[model samples]
Structures are given as C-alpha cells and as structure tokens.
Target: MITPTSDRGTKQVHDGQDFVEFTRTFRAPAEDVWAAVTDPGRLARWIGSWRGDPADGEVWFRMLFEGDEIPEEHMAIHQCDAPHRLRVTSTSPSEEGPQVWDFRIDLVEANGVTTLTFAQSVPDAQLAEGVGPGWQYYLDRLMLAETGADPADIDFDDYYPALKEHYRELFA
Candidate 1:
C-alpha cells in the first residue's frame, strides 16, 4: 500500500520565481545519490536515460517509463557540480507550443545520509498540479531504485489525482 504521507514536497519562492520542491534522504552517500540522478544508466532504472555529453551543455533524454511513443526531451545543463548540484532547463513540445522547465537538484551529506532536494520552477499553480505529483512519483521511484528495489512497483495512479489538490493548495 502506498502511504499518503509520501508527499513531502513544499512550494516556495526564490529570486522572485515560484518553485515546487521535494526532498529525499537516503542512507547512501552523496555520490550514490548523485549517480542515481545524473548517470544515464542509473537514471534508466528509475525515471529516464539521456544521450549526448553533458559537457556540451545539452543532452537528449528519453523517458523509459512513459513508453516509446513520447518524444525525447532536450535538456540544457546550466550548472553541474558532480555529486552535489545540478541545474538544467528541459524543453519539450506541447499542444500549445514549446514547454520549458527549469529544474534544480542539490545534495548534502552528513554521517552517511545523503539528502537530495529537487525543485522545479513553475509559472503558476495550474502547472504545479501536474508537476508536483509527477516529481513525487519519480522521486519515490528513485529512492526505490537506489535500494535495488523495483521502481516499477510504484504506480503513477498513486500520485496524480491523489496529490493534485495538495499541490494546488500549496501553490494557490
């Protein structure tokens, strides 16, 4: 059974931009957590995999969980500090037009536990309704993946509608 309290994200404003953030702590080290989020092969175990070199400041990411019909997303790496921090902008196509998302990940370790903070800058509460639950689901999968557990065990249905109101209230 999935716990209702699994949603621990918060909404915040930084530098005049609104953001929805989620934080997860792992007993593993920062390096392991970092690899889970950055390494293409490791990421494939949870969310998605990427191609192209990050040193080029961009990569193409194809989500493995979403099936093969979805197009690959283009991500521009703004900042990357191995095993610690990462900032990127993701651009994808939508019915309205091109959608761009700004994301930031930061990690801190102390006495073996590594804490990862994931944030996405959003324009409004409407956007966060989906973004919040989506990230919560993905981050939970990430936690499972790092522990060698099957991330596939998690269902997207557990997140979306269940937490949509929660996110709407937070951003509203």
Candidate 2:
C-alpha cells in the first residue's frame, strides 16, 4: 500500500500534447539511475523486462510484475541519449484496438543525486485516472528495487481508486 508520504504525479501540456509526469530522486549517480531504467536486467526487478537489441531501435517488452498472462509490447525507440533522456513509443493490444503509447524519461545529476523525470502522453483525463496511479506504483516499486528491497511489497490497491480522484482533478 502507498503511504501518505508517497508523491503523486502531475498533469501538464507540452507542445499541446497532454501528459502525466512523475519525478523520482536517487542518491546514486545519473549513469546508475539511467542504467536502472534502461537496462533490461535492472528493469526486471521493478517494472518489466525487455528483449532485442536497443541499438535496433526496437524491442519486445514484457511486464513481469503485472499478471500471469504477460503480453510483450512492441516498443519503438524514438530518441535515446544515454544517462539523460529517452523517448519511446509502444503498441499494445487494448479492448478497443491497438493502443499506441508515448513515454519519456529524463535524468539529471546534481550534488551526486540523480533526479529522474518520467512522462507519458495520454489521450484524455479519464485514462490518466488509472495511468497516474499505475505509474506511481511502478515508480515506487522501482525505488524499492534500486535499494535492493522487494518491489512486490508495494500493492497496486493502495494506488488506484484511492488516488484516482487526485489525478482526475488535474484535468479539471
């Protein structure tokens, strides 16, 4: 479950595109934090794992922590600047049809601390209700993973529904 101390994301517009953004800080260096997000092995500890060479600008990502029937998402890397920024687009099967998602991750180091900013473009506020908390859960899990703690200790139930209204209000 998420504690009151856990931070929530904000809604913003960049170039007229709606996005939900979250920020996380790590005592580690920028390169270390960057590897935690980009490296397939490190990612598997928190969010998910990926296959295929990133140099190919594409990879099949699987969300290991989600559920049993984990589907591989086709992620296309749009831009990659090591230890700083990464932009990617992913296509996943949705109830309506194939859903395309745009995600961005940026990292900056100051005073030996790395600040990681993550953003995902959303089509509407309704979607952000769920997406916001979902990312919060994963990002929190990432924190645990980075500290060598079990990410599974964080529950999704504490995020959704409970924090849904907070995110929905961002649009209002």
Candidate 3:
C-alpha cells in the first residue's frame, strides 16, 4: 500500500549545501536492487534508460521522463560505485544558461534486507518540494519492478500536485 506523503518521513540535509533525502527499505537483497538500478534494461521500466559506462567517468545519456511527446533530456553519469552508490548529474539547457541537479542513490544491506537512500541536491532549495513526490513515485516504480509485480504503468497525476502540496507544507 502506498502511504500518504504526510506520513512519510523525508529529511533535509546540509553539508554547506542543501539536499533532500528519501529512504526506503526493501525486503530484497542489495545486489538485486543494485542490478535493477545499474542495468539500463531494468531502469527503462521505471525511469529512463542509460547508455554509458560510468566506470569511464562522466558519460552522457538521454533521459525520458514522460512519454514520446516530451523531448529527452541530456544527462551525464557522474559516478558509479557498483552495488553501493550511483551518482548522476544533469544540466538542462535554457535561456538562463543551464539548470543542474545531482542525484545520489545509495544502497546497503543488513539482516537480509536492503535499504535504499535516494537524494537530490540543487543550488535552489525550493526545488526540493517539487522533486520530493517525483522521486517517491520513481522509487515506488523501482520497488514494483524489483518485486516481480505485473506490468506497471505510472501515472503522473497520482503523484505531482498531490504530494507536491504535502512537500510544500512540510518544507515550508
């Protein structure tokens, strides 16, 4: 069951900069979760697919968040640490020069369960409220794909304004 955003715990961290972190514990193994994240084939099921070797350093890839109508956003793989962490940074071209955000995915296993920590940091702190629900929904898709659930189709309407309001209230 999907819990209400009001009930979920999200924290803001600052190491001289701001970061929004979301945590989820899966009853699956760490390696399994890691594979789902690292493999482009599996990632396509939830978020967009990648086509690069992170080991070789910053590799560029296209991101597809919405359907075919939306243009793919060019993103780059910033870092990859196997079944432990995956870091990515993306710059969106705009008249304002470029908008950038860093995504960090960290995984750890203990007592047969794996815990995934997903975080996103940007220069503007206000962005977190808008991003909170988006990441939650994507992670939910990750859980569905990992658990062998049936064909999963994510609806943006189910998350956006709904959780966005919650995030705004909480972060405000």
> Across residues 1-172, which tens digit of lDDT does each residue of candidate 2 receive?
4352367898877668888999999999999999999898899888988999999999999999878786789999999999899999999987799888899999999999999999998888798899898898899999988988888787888887899888888866
Over 4 Å off, model 2: 1-5
lDDT by residue (1-172, candidate 1, tens digit) is 4443365689887668899998999998999889889989899999899999998999999899988888888999999999899999999988899899889999999999998999999898898899899899999888888887788787889888988998888889
Model 1, position 76: C-alpha lDDT score:
99
Estimated TM-score for each candidate: 0.95, 0.95, 0.82
Alpha-carbon error at 108 in model 2, in Å?
Answer: 0.4
How far residue 48's Cα lies from its native spot in candidate 1, in Å, is: 0.4
User: Which residue window of length 10 is worst by lDDT in model 1?
Assistant: 1-10
Poorest lDDT segment (10 consecutive residues) of candidate 3:
1-10
Model 3, 1-172: lDDT tens per residue? 4443332436566456556677877897888889887778888877777666666665554456666754444567766778888887777666677778777889999988999988777445366567877777777777767777632565656777777766665566
Q: Number of clashes in every candidate structure? A: 0, 0, 0
Model 2: lDDT to the true structure = 0.88
Model 3 ranges off by over 4 Å? 1-9, 69-78, 151-153
- Cα distance off (Å), candidate 3, residue 73: 4.5
TM-score of 3: 0.82
Tell me how far candidate 2 lies from the true structure as C-alpha RMSD in angstroms. 1.3
TM-score of 2: 0.95
